[model samples]
Target: MKDVLMNERHMLSRRKMLGGAGAISAAVAAASVSKVAMAALPEPVIQTKPDTMPPLVPNTGRPYNPVVTLNGWTLPWRMNNGVKEFHLVAEPVVREMSPGFKAHLWGYNGQSPGPTIEVVEGDRVRLFVTNKLGELTSIHWHGQRLPNGMDGVTGLNQPGIPPGKTYVYEFVARRPGTFMYHPHADEMVQMAMGMMGFWITHPKGKHPLIDEVDRDFCFLLNAYDIDPGAATPKIMTMLDFNLWSWNSRIFPGIDPLVVRHMDKVRIRVGNLTMTNHPIHLHGHEFLITGTDGGPTPKSTRQYEVTADIAVGQMRQMDFLADEEGDWAFHCHKSHHTMNAMGHDVPTMIGVDHRGVAKQITKLIPDYMVMGERGMKDMTEMEMPLPDNTAAMMAGTGPFGAVGMGGMFSVVKVRKDQKRGDYSDPGWYQHPPGTVAYEFTGALPDPARFKADVSPGPGSMPSMAKPAQDVEVKVRKPAGGHSGH
Candidate 1:
């Protein structure tokens, strides 16, 4: 029976090759691939680097512009006769979140936040999902309009793909937009282990809604709750994920969005974590062009400096890279930019622990007093870290320490950057008198303004006048109870 299915698919594919696809029904490609020798699954392509790979231009399918996945790579698919086929293997892998830190996670292909899958609109897509893990898992095509049975819900739509078994998903790329893929089975543990990836369906032609840009980039927002010196995340952690990441990578690990000067750039960002993120870009303003549902209407578009991405939402922004300098791009949430933070540590601002440190050091020599001034000093000071742990803040800029960690990256818009080139152009070299300089002259007292008072009837004279220093003397009580 399975051999018959394989032979039928082979014949249908041959028909598709001979331009007989018009008569083929969707049900013909709905069945799982056969175990026959001719129905072998396409070999899965794996990427080992945690860097932004070049855009993967489709060579076998309909032509369309590709997107660069920051700190990730696109999954290469093989065209079987005519249908684009992709194979995804769910298994345990090690992902280096930053230079000095690596986490044990379960993901597709080879790394956490698995390689992105790009397809063209209106193309027939077939995915061979082979589960190599020790448990059941399924891939939910987030925000894709497909047959209800192919929705990938473990119980509602279909049963879970058991361990070491292969399940097939067949769908047509009906729309052109960005989406996410992750396990619907054991979501809390599997997703927390970083089992997720991005999917992009590009428009086949010059669609009216989609714009042409020089640089198109995509990444997913995720987080991990791993302890110091640990390689696995605490799956039960709900609200307190210590290590926030972009594509399972932290600052210093995340690559910059290098763009040519004045080039129109598009950045697609999706949030799969448990919280919302206000993604902010410096030195430029952008319009919210696309979302997970679809492209925003032109009349409804507005310019914004920061796009707030809610949980399970995708926001693609388009901007002109007019500024010719390295600009900071990061999450507006302060804590999200920190890595492996000590949440229970008390803030030591304005506390003089010098004498106490001396006494404590006598008992424990390695006890270091930190946060006395601010945590920024840790970026500059040489401090010891736990095994396989990244610092709270890392990275060095041209001048000094960048003092940033997770969910932080730079946008380097250089005048010398070339088209189709995503290489780092190094730090921007400012022209004469363009860079900010320190004042060596005498410093003057900062100017101050008095609080404004609104005009109202029957208001006191003191309220209307400028604020002046007032002195009041309090009489001591006759009993003199010593302020008890």
Candidate 2:
């Protein structure tokens, strides 16, 4: 079933390159293979240096992490007596991916997506928002719980955060965990346009409840709507708002979600689009310890191989990295993998027509024929070869191995952990380990915000039920580390 389409051509090329009068000896071949095995996978992509930019301004004195002081009443505020307002604005902006195709998106901070807001559990949160766009707006504290009056609803709980005027949302932070805040006013228009961010809540304790852990990381999932060509922007209709992304855009092959070897990574994934994404990673399953609110009941904690993160939902999961390799993490939706406005073209090497086109052709050749003639001619009996970059990264063939069905990503688990024993909790330790690494990437540098950032309140006022008495215990793999 694992048919190699052009294996002969590749083999011939390999033989020609490795053979002849200057052929490599057996020892050299063995050495090369060993070296290849030992070498680390390529690093995930980094920030691109903008070619055109404003002149640099001299640095002003500032701290590594800036803080803004807020004067709160020393007296405790009652949840029953007061209501607060929070306003969120949704607007479309063009980001320069390239002149040919700027990223057309809707954002809350006047850009695609919005800013992250972290608050302490039990803190009173009042969100005041003013919408400047033509369409109406409202903010739904997704996965958050407070009084029902503060729920951002266009018609149900309160009026929409109307255009030109401010809307206030006052609520008390009860439970704590990672969550999201986005527009619920006109989901089709608002989510498509951007208007979302992380609403994190920190537990009152200084350290994690567990004794051995080190750090935490948070990730936001999103899909973008971008049209490759045609200067005019593409409007997101209810049916065809077709761009998908995690964080913000399609991650280039080289630039992907990453984690260090032998590290503990906590990922908080939120889905705001109309679609659901069954997020999957190659190599291992992750522990689902937390949900929209706080930690799940110990008895009900899940280790998910493929978690379904649906629209208007959020999930918190963690995993340890015991193997070292580049991991490709992405949405399992067949349509979400679409890049560059759903053009169905491969990222071929060296074809620089547009930034997207050139990247596609150069980096991922398998997709070169996606929209080509007869490409869509497959009958129900015909299953085409998998051409996704993620599949290649996972080294799996279509219909022949794992990483198929659009549910795959690279998760580099370091090889430093003891093979026969996975008992150590070293992976979650702080600094360069799990906790610091995951949160560091998302938390803005001091330069971005002049305010304190920490976790905040989020949970539905309507909880399934108060979790009854549950036992807590350390978890172990069923077979007790088979060293597989």
Candidate 3:
């Protein structure tokens, strides 16, 4: 029923690429299919790259706008006798948090946070999950209303899928909204190992609340507790995660959101971490149009520049990209923008470490002093880092190195960008008279006063002002009242 007039050619191209997909009936899924019997199960397509795949346009069902996953991809489904079927394989994966840095984690297919699963509101959908992990696992579809048996909770709704077994889930997407899926059994270690995914249920036909947008983007907020130079996450750490990432990727690795000038854009964000994130966008204000509950009432919507998303929550924001520039879009938390090595470093501001460096270098030849002024020097200095560790900050712009990392990216709004073209259109060129320039005039230095009080030799100078000595003078009252 996807009768969208536009993108017919692209949809044809997409359908031809994946239209060969077909899976066995529900009864066949009751028995676990071995490697030799792969022909009886749906083909498990795996993606290892951290780049975003092309949006999957619906080729066989109700038409709707497809969401572009940042550093992720949507899972492809096969239309089988009016029921949409998808195959998910749970296994170990090596995810690249940044260039040349990888994390040993467990995920679906070949990436952490898994591939997104998109479906229409009224379509009958079927999911085939194959567990290749060491222990039992099951998936709970968050914010979804389905049959109790199909709810996917271990021991509550059904038994957990054992290792080397496959399970089938069939249901109709009763409501339309943004949702998520993760394991309910051993979720603490599994989610810490990065097992999660995004879900979207598009409303059928023209709904009264939803509107058309030029670009729709989606991603998840997740964190990790991997130590420096390590390749695996510490699954027991709850409050002190070292890496804050979007879709299991740090900034300079996450792709930018590019849109045409004046185009309407909708961004959906899901937080899976333990802490809250205040997502702030520069140079534009937006309205939160939707959440996990569904589309918000028009009367309650308000324009805001930052929306704080709590744990296990989703926030959808809509705005018009009228300004043409490369604007910042990131979390407002300062520490969340740093890499693994950025945290736990002691502050040495205003304390000259030169004296300490000379004393330490006598005993150890390789002792180096740092942070005497601030951490900005770390972005410039070529310090020796350990193996398999990400830089504290990376990414070079037209001016110089962009001193940022983790959960940071630019929203590049341009005028010449072609429709449906998602390639990164380089840096923005600012117009003259619009940018701030350094003044060429003269300036005065600050003044400081010398204290009158002085301590003994070899003592530091006191910064406090000296108190003035004054004489107390009293006058006799005209009328005496003390004796009376």
Candidate 4:
């Protein structure tokens, strides 16, 4: 049956090739190549370090710039194909220190979101596991390909890495990209307790587009749910778990992550926390070169200010640090920005239904009550405004022109001196009242603008002031806190 399917797919591909029009689908290609043949293909190799790639810039600190040892966790391999024999165990620790509240969490290794493992492209990764906890655990290489033994499926491929038994994962890093490793076993509980890390692979040599950049850095975004001190998860629903964070903590409140000006950082975005994060970076549009584990073609590539990082997906973005400052990076989901549900409030009032309902009443006027199960109860809920809405509204400045949507972060580029605010024609300046013209519709032709608008002097940062109040009110619904 498999042979017949492959032959049919091959014939179809040939026809499509001769037709010379539509794009070839991966499914069709996979069907054309037998699974056995694919398994036999040799892994791709990486040569020397790319000369074009820039060295990593050390952060501002006592050492001025240091090669810090990035910590990471090694999870046991989960078995697949119904063969559940091996067992893997690990107990990780997590903590929530936002909103002036300190709450401990459960994780696989020692951290909330495990540390990052950085390697140059083509390096073979020999993953070893040591079960530290009472429960069995395993890690599934989120997107990287490996041999059947290393696939980490609990039954068919191999047995689980039993507690106290070491499982060695050996695989060639065939692709240079961002990948994740997490426990696939009992995903609902294990992942919630935090069994994950960012696996970043770099190209062995410099590529044309990135060689000129000054530095490289990596960032991972992760979210978590907690039941206070318990090592297990308090699952709210099958799909909508309530915990939220980045690298496992809300932004701004967490230590400020920094980057130098003109440095090219390779941000490896991983969304493992069951929610899609609309990540937006301030100042520049990052080039998204890869997704999952493979290189994305030039046509489908994206260069955008805001991009969605779906749950269980990874996105690799290359951005030049043209702007410098304390850039704020966070999940676009408003709830994730706070320490916890109703977190911005004075106390730890977990998921206040009444407060939420009352706030909803203000944003959405007509409130209807659905007594029993039905669609009548559902109404359009209010949403948070765009992160850059204020900047855009402030009108036609260079920074103001870029609208926001993706998970947001800032890059502070160094400036020689401050140029006064306002669009002056002598330097790079748009004509007065041009801000309205930019967002309302198509941009005016550059030729129409006066030549004086060309670059002249540096300018001061025009901090955005949103006309509308940015505070998000949280009120419990008609019911009390007991609703959850």
Candidate 5:
């Protein structure tokens, strides 16, 4: 039976090839190749060090290696007559978002948010793409100034790369900056299904700001609308999304940004989602040093606690890991921090459903009411979900359940951390007297907190007027003198 099916597919492919360009359904090709065969293929060699240029100057006060992608790696390339050559295969992939959850996606060279392509400025690149997907596709080099012929736009720039066909894109790495690549054909569906990757071009010579970073990391920001139990994303979703990811991975499962204290860190963030993401980094201030266009001018650099990366945009943030702690880095939008939220579920807070639940339980023994007081209980409950549904709110930290998911991760900076060590440093340990504590007895004197009300030089003016002589009142507990 399998042989018959194979023969039929071959005949169909031959007919399609005769009609026009060589074409074959991705499903048919995938069926022809077994999982074992795909696994048997050798891993792509990732060249971390540049061969043509001198080594980058040490910036982080420690030796710098290739930026370690938490759950990712860089793509290797070969030099052919001074031009770098890279081979990328576009096919289907089952990516593990975190433990216990995976999504079926289409990407290049086996991984979604395909492997990072790193090159030096002025080097010409010859990228060969082989399409194994069931549909036709094209790759648009987002933000790269390439010739119109190699732009990778179907019907506009050139004909799309049909299934089972190969196309070559040659361009010079003109500017040193961050860029992205994704399918221009069926972009809405393909990009939503995780077809994207990072492109990094380093300056040919000494670049003080860009080359000084102790650690440089890049990842793509994408979103999906897969329900809790589904294995595939809903490609039709426009705005309302459930799974927010960095490189198709959610928090906890996403690798934490690890660095040593005082290390100069550069985080390259690319947003491909429908909405803009105000990426906030806790416990530190950073400067937006670069964008998709190119490096930001030094005069335009400013310190910011949060930087907003809009859709189809990329930004590079530079900062010093001077503070030793486990700080959070995530999207500021509250809903963007969660996964697989059921949008249709009605609010059950403040409702007593016990009576109705009891009646329903008589008919369905396993039925239970939820969200009575709030959604907090749902985070703890392990309800029967669909076969492959991802836990909407999952992951537990050392303190307790994190109670959050999606576009979130931690930045672990420790003074004792070893150089090149990417392991988690665990949670931050606060020093005694540093942690906030309640004063139970009486209100503290206001005079002790009135040191520096005046704005410092170069400080922006306060948005609101300061309060004048505000009175302080401490309310006694209902049961007075109940333990201090």
Candidate 6:
């Protein structure tokens, strides 16, 4: 199998080169034969803007859309005849995980997790990938069923898209499903550096169940192990990853999923991390309707409050936005929902370090004991961190500073939200009588009873009761009792 694939790749590369040469030869012959005609030919039209239209829901004409990613957008494609043409430039990018934090990562078209690629099922797509990095790279269309030659596997389906060179992949989008794209060459390092994107193919025509949805969203799950003060990810560290994100963004910095009340919504989540994520939706239940393979059969769809997206897998969740409020939608793994954490800290819950800290402060004036009681105070302490350190575990909520960070975000559904508006509607307001309060004017009394009283050595006498108490009788045993 390996030998066969290699031969095919070499043959394809030769064909591509010969095809280019043949086109040039033909153009030269034409120009030589008719110089005047060549001069009179009109200039080719150049498009400065993309002709991409808003994506549609699966079976319905209703537009289910995602809010703009905090620092990302959908890739724009141009229509050439009936084919869609997209250009991707793979290079290094400086992405801000949130305010005060940034990382040096590699991505396509200027953003990590790249841009969402949306197309109708059965459309012919011509994707041109230009590699600007110093090393060779290849983009594998994850979960897309296409010709083997266009599979984008380096040295397997085709040659590596060499640095400073552009490679073209043409394919007919076969199935309507959630998919992803990333480098298959040096996959571990490239993926760890944030080279990935979402690929979404809408179903052709209308399907009874998937056609119409009120809101649609797509995000890629990724993890990193960049230290708090590091600007670049430590690609070698896989198990000890500290930065968890959805589309390279942590919560509070990530845009909330906004929808109108009662709107049918679909959120497409793709996991590129090594670990599985049990994504839980607070205040609502969703059905797993589709996978990367294709749409799930109606009979097989199962409703769930949390859906597990495994490594290199994708899931499409559908739900009705019947509830109104800012509901949390996040990974259920406790630590997965938090930003950078110190994994080597010891238990300090009951350790009293005041005396030790006092002595150390005399030698080092700025020194302070940390984690002695708990870590909640660390959120407020502006300790000296290394240069380029990102405040990994930090966020501010309405009530106060939020200590939790990372793969967490809210899904906001508002009843009075304006149509086509994706803005947040603030926090939820309770009805006049729904809020909890302290009960002050309440009284209860226990039943009173009388019993014989006996005291042992070293025992104290029973305390006197109020006027409503029953009388007690004292008793002495026939033989003197010794108390030990």
lDDT of 2 at 417: 42
Each prediction's TM-score versus the true structure = 0.86, 0.53, 0.84, 0.54, 0.77, 0.77
Task: List candidate 5 segments past 4 Å from native.
Answer: 1-65, 208-211, 436-484
lDDT of 6 by residue, 1-484 (tens): 1121122211211112113544434433433223122222111111111111133222222233432333355655555556666667788877878666788999976678786777777888877676768898999999999999888889999888766566677899987888889999999999999999888887777866574687777788899988877789998976768889888888666777778999988888999998899999999999998888888889998789999999999998999999887788899988787777666655576679988888998999989677776877777887776666555457776666677678988888988887666666787776687656778976778765556656458767769857797677544443222221
Q: RMSDs, each prediction?
A: 10.0, 26.8, 12.0, 20.5, 12.5, 14.9
Tens-digit lDDT track of model 5 for 175-277? 8898999999999889989999888887877776565677787888999888777888889878878899988888767878888999999999999999899
Off by over 4 Å in 4: 1-89, 96-103, 208-213, 227-233, 236-242, 342-410, 415-484
Residue 126 displacement in candidate 3 (angstroms) = 0.3
Per lDDT, the best of the predicted structures is: 1
**Residue 304 miss distance in model 1 (angstroms):** 0.4
- Candidate 6: lDDT of 397? 67
Model 4 lDDT tens row, 4-42: 112121121111211222222222233212322221211
Candidate topping TM-score: 1
Kindly give the number of clashing pairs for every candidate: 0, 52, 0, 51, 3, 8
lDDT of each: 0.84, 0.46, 0.83, 0.46, 0.74, 0.72
- Candidate 2: where are CA atoms >4 Å away? 1-89, 95-101, 206-215, 230-236, 239-241, 253-255, 341-484
Write the candidate numbers in order of decreasing lDDT.
1, 3, 5, 6, 2, 4
Candidate 5 shows a clash count of 3
Clashes of 2: 52
For candidate 5, the TM-score is 0.77
Q: List the residue pairs that clash in candidate 1.
A: none
